[model samples]
Target chain A: SQQGEEDPQALSIQEGENATMNCSYKTSINNLQWYRQNSGRGLVHLILIRSNEREKHSGRLRVTLDTSKKSSSLLITASRAADTASYFCATVKGDSSYKLIFGSGTRLLVRP
Target chain B: DTAVSQTPKYLVTQMGNDKSIKCEQNLGHDTMYWYKQDSKKFLKIMFSYNNKELIINETVPNRFSPKSPDKAHLNLHINSLELGDSAVYFCASSQDSQPQHFGDGTRLSIL
Candidate 1:
């Protein structure tokens, strides 16, 4: 079953603009991870934020997690045309969980 | 080289036929998994194998089976495929169950 639900199913933004995606999941998770998928390809891991952590950043990506509300957000700064892809949030529940439950994903389109 | 790879990127088969999608991960991870993405783009976990042992199995039908010949390879075999079974099956791997790496996915079409 899918644990996460992302808001704004589709997002369109101009190049250099900032894109933010929100995800809400049920149940307690050990960590939440964000992934990016290009058209007709596999998903690539973006960043992971642990339940004990509030926020994390990697280059142009910033991820914030709120355990109390079971919600998380991913922000991409200075979006580029190459950033056009579907973004998904996955959760790892329980201790030493082996499987990941993914969200429906947010389709991001960056117009150059 | 691809870290996680699945064979036959695309498969079109008639309903009720049996087929298998092969997956191999060279990352030497201890865990591997299979997930199905439906037409609506909802990804759900089907199975997970750790060190050639079944760890996680969701409410998937018995028609779908995962076989791990070794720690590096996990294959999914389906029997009596149905129209509803048409979806993109992804193979993924992770070490100690952290961030996982996914394959290009196999698009299965049941006709």
Candidate 2:
């Protein structure tokens, strides 16, 4: 079953602008991870935030997790045309399951 | 070197035909997985293996069989393929609970 649901099925933003995507999950998770997939390519891990951690950052990518709300957000600062791609949120259940339940994903288009 | 690689980036065949997709990882990871992405871009786990042992098997059909000849190799074979099997299949590998590294994907189209 799918555990995560991302908001704004699609988003269009201009270069240099900031893009934000939200993800909501249904169950308790050991960790939440954000991945990016370019057109015709595989997914690349962006950042992972543990349930006990509220926020994490990698370069221009910032991720926040709120276990109380079972929600998380990914923010890309100074978006570039290369940032245009589909972003997905995946959850690892706290039950020691190795499977990753992925969301439908958010398609982001960054215009140059 | 590619951390994970899958063979036959694209596969096109008719229904009722049998086909196989092979995957290998050079990261020396203990766990490997196979996922399918539907037309709607919904990704789902099909199977997982750890140390050459099947560990996670989702509600997939029996027509789909996975084989792990060794810890670094995992292959998926489908028999009597159907049109519904047309999708992008990805192979991934990881160590324990760490993040996974995925292959580009195999775009399968069944007529």
Candidate 3:
């Protein structure tokens, strides 16, 4: 079963714009991760935020986690055409389980 | 070097035929996994192996089998393929239970 649900199934923006995607999960998790997939290819690890941490940043990517609300969000600042891809949020529920439940994903298209 | 890799990036087979997708990881991770993504883009976990031992097995069909030879490779074999089985299969590996690294995926088509 899928634990995370991303809002705005599709997003389109011009270059130098910012793209924000939201994800909500059903259960408590140890950490949440964001991944990027280009076309039908493999996934690239973007960022990960533990449950105890409220926010993290890497390069132009910003991730926030709200364990109380069971939600998380990914923000891409100054998005570029190369940033066009599908972004998925995954949740690691229990430490013992060690399985990630992925969301349906948000498709972001950047127009150059 | 590629961390996780899978053979036959694209697979096409007819119904009732058997096929296998092989995967190998060079990250020296103890855990490996297989995930299936349907046409709807819903990704689901199929199996996970740690050191050639099955650790996580979702409620997948018996026809879908996962084999982990040693700790460096895990292969998926499907028996009597069906149209519903057509999807992109991904192989992934991770250190302990940390973040997983995925392969390029195999786009399987069943006719």
Candidate 4:
């Protein structure tokens, strides 16, 4: 069974526009992580937000986690054509940190 | 230097054959994992090893075996491959519960 489900299966926007993707999970998690994957390539870790943390930022990327709602959001500010990729949200359950339950992923396209 | 690397970027084999994919990490991480990505791009965990000890094993078939000789290397061997076994396999490593570093993935096609 999938633990995380991402909203907006696909999103297309201009280069300067911001891209936001939301993810919702079923059970409690110890931490949530966001990753970016280019076509035909592997995933790259973007950012991670712990259960006790509300928000985290890395350069132009921002991640917010709402534990009460069991949801999280990834925001790419001032997106660029190079930012075009698939974004996935993964959760580490409170029971085990060794396994990561990944979402279906949201594909974002930034048009120049 | 590559952080996590997998050999044979692409593999095409016939059904009922045996094949292996090798993975190595230079980050000196204590934990390593193997994941499979289907055509839909949905990634799932197959196995995990910590310090050469199997820690997590999903509902994968017995034909798929993962061997970790050391903390930095984990290899996957599949016997009697089926058509449904075609998928991209990724190797990842992490320190404790931190973010994972992934390889470029090996695309396996069973004919």
Best first by TM-score, ranked: 2, 4, 3, 1
Q: Model 1: per-residue lDDT, tens digit, A14-106?
A: 999999999999999988999999988889999999899999999999999999999999999999999999999999887657768898899
Q: How does residue A94 of candidate 1 score in lDDT?
A: 75
Show how many residue pairs clash in every candidate, following the order shown: 0, 0, 0, 0
Cα TM-score of candidate 3: 0.98
lDDT of 3 by residue, B1-111 (tens): 988999999999999999999999999999999999999788899999998899999999999999987899999999999999999999999988788999999999999
The digit string of per-residue lDDT tens for model 2 on B26-65 reads 9999999999999999999999999999999999999999
Native-vs-model 1 lDDT? 0.94
For the record, the alpha-carbon RMSD of candidate 3 to the native fold, in angstroms, is 0.9
Docking class of 3: high
Candidate 1 local Cα displacement, residue B58, angstroms: 0.5
TM-score per candidate for chain A alone: 0.97, 0.97, 0.96, 0.98
Clashing pairs in 2: none
Candidate 1: regions farther than 4 A off = none
lDDT digits (tens) for residues B1-111 of candidate 1: 999999999999999999999999998899999999989888888999989999999999999999999999999999999999999999999997678999999999999
Residue A67 local lDDT, model 2? 97
Q: Is candidate 1 or candidate 4 better by TM-score?
A: 4
Clashing residue pairs in candidate 4 are none
Model 4 CA deviation exceeding 4 Å by range: none
